[model samples]
Target: MKLGKEYQQLTPEDFTINPEQPEDFQQAIAQLVTQSTSWHGVVQCCGHDFTGEETSVSETGYGSTLLLVQALVKAELSPLPRLWLVTQGAQPLDSHPVMSGVVKSSLGMVKTISSEHPGLRCVAIDLDPQQTVEEQARMLMAEIWSESREDEVAFRQGIRYVAQLIDSHWTQSTLTVQQYQFLQQIKTASISERQNILRDYLQSEIVQVLGMNHEQVDLQKPLNDMGVDSLMALELRSRIKTHLEVELKISKFVEGVSISDLATEVNEQLEQIETNQENNLDNEEQINSAEGNNIDWLEGEL
Candidate 1:
């Protein structure tokens, strides 16, 4: 399967980056969305293993980042943020930055750490699955030019958008009812309450939705440390939306936050929801009891 074709078929927007110029690629991505200001940088991890003969890049255990960036350019997500990836022994660094403006993963690092001296095991990888390369660039321009608040919000939206995009490309599954309800709580809850609600529901839903043991998705730990990447976040976000029937911004509230915090937010919102429901039920019961004693219908018929 070609990454570009697959991405084009599965995704709603065009995301293409400069095959030759990483900087151009970043600028392109920022343009497609809103609320984004500037990109920190971009790094290509070791995922860019693509062959000219194939329609999409092969997921052949290495170098898929290039294909991903290519897709971004094609899709035209503007304000392309910077790119980052590990340095392959053969990578052309003079042309590409050690890390692009946006965050990135280093597959090379993963390979290196696998050896006896596994020191640099923990690293972050960011991918743009949404707008094209041009769009990403536009997003950057808008961000750089916009005010601070505007830039922050835009950046939040951009990452969230990218998370959703990646999720769409990677997974295809229907959501369960519980996932739906949990999503609703996440959307309306206040920041404090949302954290509580997320914690309560995430614990229950991780197994049901992600098919992992409770121990695997420990909410007490940080997401990056838990081995959760942008793609996983995207998958989680997608499932939550599918089940919850609402679109939650993965980047705005979910990104860079610890699983513990998320779980806490979820729990708080859930508690509030339960409280509200109970209050409504109590009011209904009181009204019913009062009406029962009145016997107005019987009196009128007689």
Candidate 2:
């Protein structure tokens, strides 16, 4: 509705291609583009259509999009119209890892195509699915009008972020004596004990973060489905780092992760930390190692 005024809105009947039928879908797309020899842009908004996890490229948008790319690239038009692939929460940014969606392939197609063909203008824009429709519309409009040469971009909270590749280094934080010992004990903990410990901690965090009763929280249900958005996710992640002394991506909460599932994930991270701490043990990294019994309450909680 935000773009209804400026752009000519096409109804579903006007241009909905069935990806299951490759040849027909390809033909439909080719004819659609041939409607005008020159154009401002042809935007393909994806991630709205539902496809199963087992769906192949021929049964998904990927195959249809491939055909479109071939047509656009081979067209004898003077100035190629910009091909815009707009998706929702399909990009993994530096901090907020967007929800991976089926549109990922289409985004990559346009980016690589733009590089191979200088005359073609390809813009891949990822919008935060958590944002309101009004905000997403504004982001799309801004990117459409801006003269940025960046082929790939993502918008979060009205801020535009472009992807870049640079030399990076792995920097580890100095763990305190208590944190190191806790990790070591956690690694030695039995599978059931580990689950009980971390699951209890995660339950407490969820109850506190969402202000829900402990009895009301279901360990098997996904946290995001219980209304943990990006902001709540940030708080939950911070709480984990503070108490557990482990850093986790914000995406961990939103990607259908239940308290039970996160407990297993936390246990795995603790194992990795146990190894790293042992290898990097130094004077500064080590303090008087606390006894494993210090976290005995962890097992007792269950």
Candidate 3:
């Protein structure tokens, strides 16, 4: 059935139950699915109630969401039964380790479900819990129906933030004028100099990604060990390819790859390009000289 007026005013208390045992909670979820014909959406809130023993909170929170998703998948008659996962308190980026881990894992689940089910709409909303439940519900409903193409939204201290995923890497065009000039200057530089420049650029990027200073990064260490997740890796690869004007595969950082090694590869590519340019110039000059000789012989015959 449609979650119309009754569901609009729903609160966290509606789903609260004193479970005699954990299995009882699962039974309750099963019953929820069995009774409901269809749902407009599902809203999950993680806030003060989610803060307890780390193990308990994490297990229960994640498990409950999992069950809800499973139930929704089975019962949702319409493709667009929106799922809104709400988190309270500090944003995930600035949260404590335990809280942050839980949020990240939850978001990961949302991403996976969204990827698998194109018709299903999943959004994660983070907001401060100091506001009234009505306010929170209003904001969530607005987000559920928002036409914005963002999957993540946050409301903090009277401010609203939306995350729109765009492919920054693939859209890059030719280098800027400054970049072209710099490339021209470096084209004739020694391989050692070229490698040093590339290495320094990579080191700077790694430090920024890790949210640290350059001195804190070890260029020789593997990037994965430094907490460079898949998303960060894509960003790093994008930055390098865009600025350095070199082609690089994302898998280069898959394993045993270091900044120094990447620098070496960039240096080799530069040298190859320079060599090809020189060969082309020499062939053009020779062709011009041959044409001139033929013209001189024709003049003498005339």
**Lowest summed-lDDT stretch of 10 residues in model 3?**
1-10
Off by over 4 Å in 3: 1-38, 47-53, 57-60, 90-98, 164-302
Q: What are the candidates' C-alpha RMSDs?
A: 24.6, 23.6, 25.0
How does candidate 2 fare on TM-score? 0.44
Write down the TM-score of every candidate: 0.26, 0.44, 0.41
Which residue pairs overlap in candidate 3's backbone?
Answer: 1-38
Model 2 spans > 4 angstroms off: 1-13, 20-26, 29-35, 48-54, 58-60, 98-107, 167-302
Which is the winner by TM-score between candidate 1 and candidate 2?
Answer: 2
In the range 1-302, model 3's lDDT, one tens digit per residue, is: 11111222134223443322344344445566566646666676643455544565334455556655665555544433667777765344333333556556666767986775534567777665666887776666555643434567666445466554563111211454344335554664677787788788789888888798877777888777777777888888887777666777777775768888878877888778667766864665466457656877999999
Q: Of the pair 2 and 3, which is ahead by lDDT?
A: 2
Query: How many Å off is the CA of 69 in candidate 1?
Result: 67
Q: Which digits, one per residue and each the tens of the lDDT, describe model 2 over residues 266-294?
A: 88887787666556543211221232233
